[model samples]
Target: MKRIGAFLLTGAFLLMNVAVMAQCSLCTKTAQQLGEGPAKGLNNGILMLALTPLVIIGFLAFRWWKSNKEA
Candidate 1:
């Protein structure tokens, strides 16, 4: 299970270079003005920010599940 999770994480990281257009209207307009490179950076920043919470929740859930399974 741990190995599978690690493999999936590695794959996701490797594939993360593909453009993510996850910007609000204002951010989208700002990124458009900033051009491609900056826009991509902005998108990646947003994506990471969004994923941080999900990753934390997933880790906590995994721990909880593991403890329950052990019990």
Candidate 2:
């Protein structure tokens, strides 16, 4: 039951679609001037930068959970 609930929650999170504006006012203006290609590049760059810390934290949390489960 617990495992099923966890899987369902994870599945729900994975299925969720959300748009994030990872741009500041200055960045938005810069992208607008630079055009679509640069705008996409800027957005991807920002997302990658933001994702690094999250990846690390998620990894740490998974490891902690696994260790606790073993105990």
Candidate 3:
């Protein structure tokens, strides 16, 4: 039991270290090369990519509710 607990703790610590140590590469590049037409495209793409999942999830949730209500 103690071995399993130690293994889990090690995994958690490694994951935390990786999360904190990594830099946002896209953000760094964007900061370096500010104010250009392609940057605007990148910003717009990120916004659309972020919103796409929300829109899809919302649609699926509404469909799920509607189908469950009729049953």
Q: Which has the greatest TM-score? A: 2
Rank all candidate structures by their TM-score, best first, as comma-separated numbers: 2, 1, 3
Evaluate all candidate structures by whole-model CA lDDT and list the values in order.
Answer: 0.92, 0.92, 0.70
Tens-digit per-residue lDDT, 1-71, candidate 1: 99899999989998885655789999999999999999989988999999999999999999998999999
Write candidate 3's Cα lDDT for 1-71 as tens digits. Answer: 99799889969975773322122587648745875666656666666777789889989998998999999
What does candidate 3 score in Cα RMSD to the true structure? 10.8
Q: How close is candidate 2 to the true structure, as a TM-score?
A: 0.70
Q: What are the models' TM-scores?
A: 0.70, 0.70, 0.49
Candidate 2 — worst ten consecutive residues by lDDT sum?
12-21
Model 2, 28: alpha-carbon shift in Å?
A: 1.3
Q: Residue-wise lDDT of candidate 2 within 1-71, one digit each (tens)?
A: 99999999989988988766799999999999999888989988999999999999999999999999999
**Best to worst by lDDT, what's the order?**
2, 1, 3
In angstroms, the error of model 1 at 45 is 0.9
Clash totals for all models, in order?
A: 0, 0, 0
Error of 3 at 22 (Å): 19
- Higher-TM-score candidate of 1 and 3: 1
